[model samples]
Target: MTPIGNLKPTIKIYDTTLRDGTQGEGVSLSADDKVKIALRLDKMGFHYIEGGWPGSNPKDMEFFDRIKKHQLKNAVITAFGSTCRPGVEPGQDANLKCLLDSGVKLATIFGKSWDFHVTKALNTTLEENLRMVEESVAFLKGNGLRVFFDAEHFFDGFKANEEYALAVLRAAVLGGAEAVILCDTNGGSMPFEIQQAVEQVAAELPGVELGIHAHNDSEMAVANSIMAVQAGVTQVQGTVNGLGERCGNANLCSIVPNLALKLGYTTIPRDNLSFLTELSRFVYEITNLNPVANQPFVGESAFAHKGGIHVSALMKEPGTYEHMDPASVGNVRRVLMSELSGLSNLLYKYKGLNLDKTSPEGRKVLEQLKKMEHKGYQFEAAEGSLELMLRKAMNGYREPFQLQSMRLILEVREQQPIHSEAVIKMRVGEEIVHTAAEGNGPVNALDNALRKALETIYPEVAALRLLDYKVRVLEEKAGTEAQVRVLIETGNGKETWGTVGVSTNIIEASWQALADSMAYGLLGEK
Candidate 1:
């Protein structure tokens, strides 16, 4: 039997990573970074990319000004802002004029849907809010603009006053909005409520195109969006990695693949969907935010497994545990080895290392890994290092360069009284290299010193920088005296990789991971 509305399902993806995504906590992309990311999104085939609020900030204005020269293919650049402020005519409002003059053919203007916001935030009555919505939308339409009206807090507004909410949407539709987007502004609505409200609105306004702009405060934005689609919405609005205000908007990374593969809805092209994971990571990297490991479909741990039973089952048939193949979303399955692993887990790791599972040497290596994991060595976070170690255990490994010794020294004094200095010395391939650097902190000093030492021998190492440095206390029994784990992410021009190190001394742990990152990069090239 054919599913209702499933035979010819269609969706339009509107990515607001540049606009709403920058509103996420601690996220601010420079104009150059914004343009670089925008080019990437356009190449990835997003239908619409919200460039930014043209008049809201200098960076956004600069981005639009700079992006005019490059011709974007397959994606329309959108300038986003609120409708003309209350008590002001659309033709005279600076914000509305700025959006129109930005040279962007597509524009998204949000208007107050909730009566509370209209009454309180705007300090205006319901009639004024309706006029603001209508006038702003009509002005943009008359100026040859494809406008999308974001009914901010639509669901909440509907619950508060159904007639007012319908009236707001009616204003947008009557004003010639290309799409009327229902925003779960507070992101507190559930899927059931979303379905009911969207169905009601669709039934009432059958002539208007519907869009869903949701947030993830309730952790149901993606689900709610899907429910809205089932209830007849055609456009989905979201950020690339669920980045936005508060708990963030729906994640386009998850939404695009879910609608395409699971629901069989056509939104982005099939070929473009395969780049979802890469694009998700790209945006996260540019924002200097770590990608959530557990995020659905595209995260690092989404396809990672460690349990013995699951590994055994997966070895025979991956469907035993996996909901979908990892490659379906441009990711690969990873078998993690730890204390909880059984022989099958060991075999899986062995196969990954390209070693014979039946070999005595392989068995010895597996036993060694189990013993090391028991001693607090985590292989999951140091997969590259673990692979190198496995090759060494099998006597098939070749060292790229031998480290003779490393010395790091730090000296500090208050500038008001005295000054300080730090130095690091290392012996690489029989040549002793020494370099000194100053930093505000001990870890920064150590990082600079070590990179200085390696740059002479490996010029390519200079292209890589430490993007992230994380520390975790493993054993805090003695309070200040405890073992810590350090994870470092390093990026060269082409790719980024993570390495881990653990020690009682934080400096030592950081150094170990830093060294491993450089070694892995050099060795992997061979």
Candidate 2:
């Protein structure tokens, strides 16, 4: 901590997704991905975007070169590396040279703060390590670059030998580093340890700027970060979706909101907070990883309500169940329909419709919903299908097309292939259209036949795309004789919707979901 007298209201966000995040297993990014993420983070008002360690790989060096062609508005592209090697001049160290060549004005470099690391890992004297830290910062500063020093393993090192860790930071300050960030390199420090250590640093280095770079090995990274902020650090270093080497770094998704909404700290332009959910999902998408559904603030299930009592309270006032408005974080509140759902969930889902819980029709729909749920139909994942059921029961809605009859044939040839075909009859308006189609599978053949029969009557049916299909076994013990539920997702180039069906027969379940998907898409009901 440089002796900065008072902590500022605004906490700088130092994002290291392109660097630390990519270190996580199964996480990799192209140079183009880095640029896209950097630009988005800048637009969202992050204070710093760590491009990557240019000394480590070609893709990172390529990122530095490519990002220079475009100007960023808010975020400063910072390059990351370690302090000069033991006994080497900072000017000649390849690591330091890469930082200079990265063409970024700001650089963050780490050095061993724990004496054990200096003695055991670096195999160098503690005094030489301090000199390395100081000279590395001085060399980068002399080259006209702002430097932030990461005192690696500061927490554990401080606990082990308090005097030496503080000495490490003092060396960085003497070398003209702008900020000193305490790193929980091993990700095993307790929050109390972090607070006590950070407070000690703030008091000792009164005018210094301090930051915390926490890891989530103990599932306390987010908690430790907030505690550090409260303990007087003015900057938070984290990765989106908590992506990092092992357990992960602190999740900026959770940290930003906890600081801004709860602690009243300013971060990333308060209004831009609504983009938090989108930003979290975007990073997961770019990394080709599935989004965590129950992740805090930005997850799909974060604000979702399912229990009847919870939904009842939430319907009257969202604050009863939600800590904060979902829209504030670019997430929406979901009133899920399940066996546990009450009339309140139904009423909330049917808010715009002319339906009331007291009505006989409404009671019928609720009973029907419960019965379906008991039989393995999950309306929560197939709200489109649920909506259709409610419309038919409560609003006397008629189907766009009725299934008359269907037949299928499978030909098992000698050595070529097993071919499947479907013949279907559908009543569209006053005419009955019969069609036949072949497909690689029975379900696909049924889909093709259904489309061929209805496309002429409703051209939009041809544009409907089956985005995803999933099947779940209701009872594993029943195995071959078990009832199954099929869920289908359909898109119309604009939006997507889900439909579900259940049956003992896989083909029948698939057809039911497929037909419902088509009907839901054709009706264009939200």
lDDT per residue, candidate 1, 349-368, as tens digits? 66656554466766676678
Mark the 10 consecutive residues where model 1 has the least summed lDDT.
413-422
Model 1: pairs clashing at backbone N, Cα or C within 3 Å = none
Candidate 2 clashing pairs, residues 3+ apart or interchain: 2-207, 2-208, 2-209, 3-206, 3-207, 3-208, 4-207, 4-208
Q: Residue by residue across 380-474, what tens digits does model 2's lDDT show?
A: 88988998888788655768889999899999999978899999999986789989999988999999999998887888787899999999999
| Model 2: residues with Cα > 4 Å off, grouped in runs | 1-8, 524-526
TM-score of candidate 1 versus the correct structure, residues matched by position: 0.81
